[model samples]
Target chain A: MTSTETHHAAGAASSTDAPAIATWLTTADHKQVGRLFIGTGLVGLLGGLVLAVLVAFERIDAEGFQLLDSGSATQVLSAARLLLTFGAVAPLVMGLAVAIVPLQLGSRSIAFPRVAASGFWMWLTGLVLSVAAIIGNGGPSGGESEMVDLYLAASVVMVLGLALAALSIAVTGLTSRAPGMGLLRAPFFSWSSFVGSIALLMSLPVFIGTSVYLYVDHRYARAAFGGNFGVNNWVGWAISQPFTYVLAIPVLGFVLDAIPVLGRTRLAQRPAANVAVGLVSVAILASLTHRAVTLPWEGDGFFSGLGTKIADLLPFGLVNVIPLLGLLGVLGLTMLTLKSAKPMLAAPLPFAVLGLLMILLGAASHLLYTVEDAALGGTIFEAGSYVAVTFGTVLLAFGGLTYWGPKLWGRRIPDKAALPLALLGFVAAALGSLPYMIAGFADQPAGVVDGFAYSGPQELWNVVTTGAFALMLLVSLAFIGLAVRSFTAGEAAGDDPWDGTTLEWATSSPPPADNFSDLIVVGSEYPLADIKNSGKVG
Target chain B: MLTLPPAPQPAPKRQVFVGTALVSAAATMLVGGMLAIWSQFRADAPFRESPRRGPIKDWMPKDIVVPEVAANMMLIAFFVVCVMAQWAVWSAKRNDRQHAGMALGMTLLMGLATLNAQLFIWSQMGVDVRGGAFNSMFYAITGVMTFLVIAGLVYTAVATFRYLGRGNSDVPTLSAHALYWYFLTAAFSAVWFVVYVQK
Candidate 1:
């Protein structure tokens, strides 16, 4: 009848049974939140992907190029924009990265779980309210003002939550070790997640704070940083700085996974990862200056002047491009070596390859625009480049789920049917974004608020985009159906599915409460590989 | 092949009692103190017939009205909600049906009291520029938080009703949930200081 014993008694249910609602309330277990994060993040991904398809179709046929085109067809496009901007802060990034990164790094609980949970709840609140605000207030306030508040709040909650999650991860990494875990012995995915979590901790908060400032102006009828007050310029800096690689970290994880399997040994240069990780982290922080800002510098004379001079210098921009180039190097290595693997014609492999490909496309496309913007800026071209970010994230999210859902859940997805269905989703999304690139480059009208639709080649571009949409929708339907089936009644899976090369695979298919009965610290990068090739993994 | 180690034996009852007390004290100190300041400032805004001279007005600018009071009260209620929630978690973990039921009831009652106090204050207020946004924000934030608190209470009540009879309270998931309740309570208190008291 002791309190400690009280909470612990209700957990003896079957893994297949639904968790008790109270259990969800009284629990502070990281694993529960982590699983919920994964589930909810995937749900968000599903909703977002479907939204993307609607957007894609609209891009192709803005002027009614749908199978069921009517004036109402525009609702699909409008809905997509609403979803996209529903929260200006990235949901997939905040949701998945914060949720998954912590669990992947072996932690008891987030350092600030209350803050973390509050962050998430408030974010939900923000998005829901913003969407409601948009619905209630039309035209002038619609998407721009009323809807923007919810996202602004979401950004704050996410920033707060993520900072807490990252702190938790770092605390766990720093202090929560069982008997023998060391920095060097940490799991590679966790190591990468550690690095990614740091990037999140530092960068996301600034973005949230920046967005809040912009929001306050809109809310109170002050132009503190929007309108002529410098919202546009400031946003250019803020979004580009944190997000470009708020994105890169996950891709970095996938890249880590891809590299070893192709080489089948330790990374050719393992120390370089630490160095590269640090460099990218700095680069993201430094890029903030590039955001058009309006600051009245205090403290008169030489010292202050030198600071301002340094801010304006190209070295700052150069600092950013350096890590980006290093990341490109990582991706390049993957592309060359991936050909070495037997291309396991399975669910994740194609998606992984395509994901890596879109990342490369996005990197190159964006790099081109940054270096010179006549061909891109605000055009469908820029949209296509941005698509690379979402495309890569979505691909990996779904692909990773498919490749390892069985291992994680102890349940097998319908591989033969589900694999192709998932791949089609990826292909459809990729092809869907392509027309945006063409439209931008061709100088067809772009920018959401701009009503200046191009007169020439518009119809043709619209047609191509609509065609892409048709394919994407079919793919989305297929994926959702498969996800639902897998969760509900997919075949029971076993340990070692996909011959997964990580500590995660070494445990039971769904894993036990403590993760491992006895913690097995790795001495090297390819510990799982050593186990697979020999006998003792982890 | 990978059997987990036996679950750690539940901590001693004394330890649980001490932890609950400590958490409650922290909530009161951290959360209750905030309510007093927020209420003082919220009342002060309307009390000012003309811009008076004070440290806040001098540096804060005359037109700037602070909702320090609204945030203070809301944050206090939030932590009160948290203490009840933790009490519920302690009950649920021990398989004590009566305790769990009592804890949930306490949690809901605290929420209702908070709403009553908030609406009572709102009803007494007159329309003005500086206090309007502050009051609106206060209500919005508290209203949302109240909904969450109620949701948590109901969810735990359901478990108390169903599984308490079954006599199993060892929920692996319960710890995370309790942590979040405490987390939300803590966050609201922290934000009260930042967004309200300081202003």
Candidate 2:
């Protein structure tokens, strides 16, 4: 191929030359692929939020079925959980990593760009089929066996797609660094993405293996695993506490990356930040041990032996404590960074900080949920934790979009408009989750629309939770509107709007097809800072 | 006098070997998780009274005895497969295209032999999948092994074709193919120990 043909093959040509839809379909550009993932992920978030609102509304009456029936209530809950974690949060985080990690690493393109593109399409197809199967009564507790099989099979495909994308991202981080830039010296976002992608790649397969078993047993015989009713029991670990935190792993990366830049200072304790991210990924180990190892805490032989008690408590303590320590470490590091820095009251800053706070709250709640005396398992408290992680991830993703929207679209999302949405999101996440948690203590059962009595004022809590979901739904819609409006027609963002120190800031607002027009060789962690200090560019 | 700046150096391209290693690690974990589940189920299953035998504690159905010879043969084939895969990688590194091609072909043959052996074992067992938990999990575990073998075969073939088509040895592709086979060998070893021998 000619050089120009080669360039076009590499997705260097502008979309205007060819049909836009065709260009997108065939494009191998990480930016375009990232945009596709982000767009679809937002749509997924909106759908999941709608379902969540429906679920919360159903719970409002507490004694009667409102919008969902007893038969389909659990399935809808499963669907909402499925869509929020796999469909929405994972894709959103993976999208940001795919689009920005290469740029941060100063590489011309993402590794296996075509593979990443294929991953997006495959994930989308699986997501669509999964939703369709759920609608057809094929999810965990669906009545139809075939649809349940479809959901299982489709979920495997979805997970594989995400895994493929993660492989590309992880490989890119490992192999695509610019000259003189080591892994430790790479930006916080890139480092955390590398770690998070590996975590996803490792943990997601267990889900796939479990799903395979579920599929075969459900398809062939209902003997091995509980056929339909057993679906959640087998795979629910992926969307619950600790595992749900897997989706939030990259949230810390975004928070760390955005805080220092918005504060207009270098991050304090950079290594600690990296360690915190790695510590969070350690939860993947906890997730893997979920069904494989049983914690015999509920047995009647209460205090069998000291060794037995220690062994039982060890896994629980390690599982709950490690990720919590990671979040606490992040909180401490963020505060330390802000203490000495001249901070800007930017939209992304509040979003990042508040998002981190919400995730910390979620982790703390998970630690509490593990207490045997709490009796929080199999309660809406689990839903509360899921909401905090899922919505916290949403908030972080929005912050990422706003922070990097300039680089992505050559326009800034109006900060004044976005700032309030961040606060609203925090409120929604807090209200949506905390009330459910309180009701969990009140003995509200999980995965039920009706037919349960609790002494606690479950109705009032559900009413508040419903209102919270409504607020969250509004926040999601408004954020989408802000993104669309800003990306299409907003104030022009210069090459380095935030006066950033990273390689991404060194390039044009919307980078060229090859990302950089010239080779960028880094000499320090802050390459742009080095250049500025040397007076190479003003 | 006007001076021209030096040309820019090209960026480092993607490394297939690194990608392959990551993929191999994930595949290992996938098989490891399945095997763990299999062990969990076996430990949990209660002893059943067989018509021919008094009380069998085995997870496998009493009527069907796992074809030990076939399973052992498959395990042996994988060991040979790994050696041949490494030989191919060695030849490719030395630019010995003829030897590399032969080594890869041998690896493919051995892989197919393993697959054939596994099929033989399945046919000999003839256990109904709907029989019970043991039967269901048996298929789940062995079915995944079959899929991995097929994937490894396709990978080897692509490497061989690429080496022959270009009339040159591509060390990275060959090395990655070797790593994948090694992973397969390890996975099958676990399968043999846990499912075939232990049962």
Candidate 3:
């Protein structure tokens, strides 16, 4: 077949060829698959954010049940965490990678495109079933036994779906790069997606393994792992501190990718930035070891001797600090890049920068939470850190969507409209997290809605956190509205609106069926820049 | 007359091999996590005095005796299975359809044999699923391993049929099939030492 025929065959189906829903249902196009993931992920984000808001509101009084009963408090908290981490963040990040990575690599299509499409549907199905199970009281510490079984089974399906998507992204990065675009030389977003995908692939299976154990032990015999109450004990690590940072691995990629382009500068210290992203994945290693090894920081003999204390603290510190250092490295590199370049005051720039700061702040808080003397292990401070990372990822997802919106859709999100949402997101993230940290420091317990004795002004902090969550809900809704309005009806974005240096910008807005009109063979990391400089195409 | 420069060649797509390697890595970690949990339980299980064997610190209950011969045979079978899987890959690369088919068939047969051995061990031991932590975990670990082996067998069958029907060697699929069996062998090795040999 001729090249044009191949491109046409690989391209997306036209509206005239099939019914719209049918075309979408069977689409192998990376862009369509990505849109499916992103659209579903946003719905999940909205659902999770609503749950978070309810949980926060329930905590406001700190003396009695308000929105939630004692019987349901823990389950709600577990469900919220599950939905936020797995349902929202994982899909959003994976969707961005699915759509954008192939374009960045100058590939005609993503590797195993059908597999990616299958992953989206499977993820959607599992997430929906998980929500149904949660509604039926099937989450961690749930009352209904059968519902618990359904939840466990659904979670496995969900995690495996994400894993399948991760596999496709990792392979695309490995085998789909344009000639001369080596791994290191690939765009930071694609590179980070690669690293992050590998990390998820390795780490998520551990969750799957644990879930299987939990399922069997819970379903047939409650002897090994505790039946319903023990669900979080085995799988909670996937949604918490070090593991949460794993979700943010691709967030760093977005910051790195967007900042350099918006600043109108080639990324300085590109290798260091790459190393920074790789370092964040170290959390995956720490997370895998989490179940097997418990840090001795809480033991009586933890402070008995200097050697013993060092032994106890070293692993804990490394696990918490390394990812923090990684985020710091990204922050430093962004600063260095922005120092000499006159950056465009674009919406994506602040979203990327502030989002990185939120994640950095969260990582820093997690390190502090590890201080044995702080006695913050079971406190709401852990929630504080979780919020920082989770919402930080949300902001980064926002940054990525705005930066790549024109490419994903055929129109750009209005800069003036999107700019304020960045600030709103920062405020929402800060308020949503810092209050929880303060409340945690004040001796308020984690995952408790009420009836805890505490001397510190926990009520005030809880009230503040409720407001923060409310603000976050508003921010999320507004951003979603803006995205929908802009994508469907906004001004048309010409190709190369950002004058992007990467290969993705060399194609038309929203790209064609084959991604590129001609296969782009690159000689440098900045292929478009090379083409423009020489006034020629490869 | 002006002529356009030759269009660049597309990069080779190795999605099958790469995707399989990723899936294999995930499977390895899944089994590794299970083994770690098993080790933890064993380390933490209390020492108990039994009538026949006094003051034993074994994680498995005193009543359960894992059939040593069958378990060992299963391990041996996996080793052979890995070898056969690799032979199929080597044969496929050379377009030797008969040898590849035979190798895949032997791999599948041995894989089924290991499954049979596992089932035999389960029957001989007669451990209840709901008996205790040890019994539950034993079934969990072994059951997951059994599932992976079943997956590997299906993979081998697909590779064999695809190779034969196409009249050409699908080396990537064959290599991926081999890699998965290798992973299964390594995973079962850990299981054997932890759940059988060490116990």
Error of 1 at A314 (Å): 2.6
* Per-model tally of clashing residue pairs: 38, 2, 1
Q: Write the per-residue lDDT of candidate 3 for residues A62-159, one digit (tens) a residue.
A: 67657788879888888888889988898888999999999999888899888899888888888888888989988898999999999999998988
Model 3 regions lying over 4 Å from their true place:
A1-7, A11-16, A291-304, B1-13, B50-54
- Per-residue C-alpha lDDT of model 1 across residues A116-223, encoded as one tens digit per residue: 455555455554553454344321223355545554555455445545555445445444433344655554445555666566554544454445444554565442
Which scores better on DockQ, 1 or 2?
2
Candidate 2: misplaced stretches above 4 Å? A1-16, A292-309, B1-14, B48-58, B167-169
DockQ ranking, best first: 3, 2, 1
- Please give the lDDT score at residue A467 for candidate 2: 92
User: Candidate 3 clashing pairs?
Assistant: A11-A513
The fnat scores of all predictions, in order, read: 0.00, 0.65, 0.82
* Tens-digit per-residue lDDT, A1-538, candidate 2: 0012123334346655788789889988898899999999999998998899898898888675567778899899999888888888988899999999998999888999999999999899899999999999989889999999999999989988999999999999999988989998999889989999999889888888888999999999899889989998888888887887777877688889888888988899999999998889878877887552335466546556768788877876677688789889988999999988898878999899998888888888877777665678778787888788778889999999999889989899988999999999999999999998988888788889787778877788988888998999999999999999998899998778888888888777787777875667889899988877888767
DockQ scores of the candidates: 0.05, 0.62, 0.72
lDDT of 1: 0.51
Q: What's the TM-score of every candidate structure? A: 0.62, 0.94, 0.95
Tens-digit lDDT track of model 3 for B1-199:
5564664344342777888889888898999988888888888888888778788775777778878999999999999999999998888778788898899899989999999999999999999999888888888888999999899889888878877755453677788888888888988999899889887
lDDT (CA) per prediction: 0.51, 0.86, 0.85
Model 1 CA deviation exceeding 4 Å by range: A1-19, A23-27, A49-119, A138-151, A177-185, A227-244, A258-266, A277-283, A286-316, A339-343, A372-375, A418-423, A453-456, A529-538, B1-199
**Candidate 1: share of reference interface contacts reproduced:** 0.00
- Looking at model 3, residue A334 earns an lDDT score of 92
lDDT of 2 by residue, B1-199 (tens): 5564665333332468888888888888788888888888888878888778777666887677988988988999999999999998888778888899899999999999998998899899998998888888889889988998999999999989977764443667787888888889988889899999887
